[model samples]
Target: MSIISLDSVCKSFGALKVADAITFEVREGEALGIIGPNGAGKSTLFNLITGNIAADSGTVHFLGEDVTRQSAMQRCLNGIGRSFQIPQPFGKMTVFENLLVAGSFGQGKSERAVEQAAADILDRTGLIGRANTVADSLSLLERKRLELARALATAPRLLLLDEIAGGLTEGECSQLVGTIKDIHATGTTIIWIEHVLHALTSVVERLLVLDFGKVIAVGEPAGIMARPQVREIYLGIEV
Candidate 1:
């Protein structure tokens, strides 16, 4: 079953088309990875799906309903949650406080109503020890974990992660991937965009390649990476 579907979705900024009649589907409980060069419109795709940017044309359907016209918060409360490429936690809030805000507002519930769930998310994302610390003081890796935790707090059925592993050390990336794998184990559908090939490939069942705002390939990771065009365009290596 497809959790989300983009049917010929299109978006543009003035003369530049960021998403050009791009179509794809993410299956329920599946992990999909997206890769491309710096200007491939990877994050723009995320914005389209999350309703952060309205498409110029086409439709976005989530779990069988057309959500293209829905607001980002509306889509979020309807089981679509995401993390930005840059971690955007509330600087003055405590680590746990950040989750509470995400959980309460995201779920449209009272903060007290989501307390336990927020605490559980902290533990799962490996932030239990730092729960009381202020968000502004967290290390890069810790902030990334908090970002993931904030998304999880929304209790999304489909999670969109954008370059969450970009700045981490190898060991840090592995540890974060471990937590992400555990999240996937629980059957949450995920579409992740990452520049870290090894970490991205480790968790995603399939890969989607984009170029200049268009989908160029979508297949098993190994097969997609082995394509001559993908190699030359994405890896800058001619096979």
Candidate 2:
């Protein structure tokens, strides 16, 4: 069953077209990876789905309901939790406190009602050790983990991760990938936009490639990456 569907969704900023009639479906409990060069409108596609950007044309359906017109806050309350490409934590808040805020506000629950789940998310994301540390003081890897943890704290049925593994060292990226695999193992649907090809292919069941705001190809990871046009456009390689 599809947990989310986008049909003919189009978006633009003045004269610049960001998403050109983009359409796709993400299955329930499936992990999907999105890949493209910079300015392919990858993040814009995400914004549209999460209601951060409204489509100029077409529809967005979540869990079989039309949510094209829903606001970002409404989408979050409906279980669409996302992490930004840049970590956006409250600098003064401790790691655990960050999760608590996300859980309570994003899920519309009280702090006490979400505490246990928040703690579990910390443990799962490998942030338990840094739970007491202030968000601004965390290392890059820890900040990345906290970002993931905060999203998980909202109890997302569908999680949208934006470049979560982008700046990590090899070992740190591996650690985050392991946590993501664990999340996927528990049947949380994921749509990850990433530049880390190996890390992405490690977790996602399928891959989608975009260029110039259009989906050039999408299929099994190996097949998608092997496509000549995809290689040329996304990797800057000649066939």
Candidate 3:
């Protein structure tokens, strides 16, 4: 069954339409990748799905229930967890403290449970060594890992990642891809929006292309990449 569904979702900012009758469904445990040009509204689409913004029309459904009007926190507690492209950890908080907050508030876990979950999440995200380090003191890659870790601390059924691999070296991107692959192995459905094609292709089985805020193509990654329209729009190639 589809864990999340967007039916004819539409949104606009003044006269600029960011989403125009956008519709798609993500099956349980499926890994779907979204790719588009800079202004194609990929992040806006994530915001719509995660309740960061309400759609102007249509419905956003999770587990077959409509949550179009739900707040972002409510959606998080309802099993939607997401990581932004820019890591937004509490600067003064330790890495572990950051996860502790996410577990407690995002997942509504008890203090003890939150502590244990934070520890496990740190270990899983390769941030165990930096547990006591302040979030602001971490390196770029560590910060990115912490961002992903905090999201996992919520124990979400569906994960939304917005360009998590952005601004990373090739080696760093490879390591992050390995971590994401492990996360997917454990049955968490993931929808990732990334411009780093290699990192995205490494993790997602299906790919969706967006152009001018509309879904232009959806299919197996290889097939989607082969399309003339996708190549022209996303890869800057004429075919």
Tens-digit per-residue lDDT, 159-225, candidate 3:
9998889888888788889989999999999999998897898899999999888999999999999
Off by over 4 Å in 3: 237-239
Q: Please rank every candidate by TM-score, starting with the best.
A: 3, 1, 2
Off by over 4 Å in 1: 237-239
Local accuracy of candidate 2 as per-residue lDDT tens digits, 33-143: 999999999999989999998899999999999999999999999999998877888899999999999999998899999999998888878788888999999987677
TM-score of each candidate? 0.96, 0.95, 0.96
What tens-digit string does per-residue lDDT give for candidate 1 at 138-188? Answer: 998788888899999999999999999988888888988998999999999
lDDT of each: 0.93, 0.91, 0.92
What are the candidates' C-alpha RMSDs?
A: 1.6, 1.6, 1.6
The TM-score that candidate 3 achieves is: 0.96
Report how far off residue 14 is in candidate 2 (Å). 1.3
Model 2 ranges off by over 4 Å: 237-239
Q: What is the lDDT of residue 17 in candidate 2?
A: 90
1 versus 3: better lDDT goes to: 1
Error of 2 at 218 (Å): 1.0
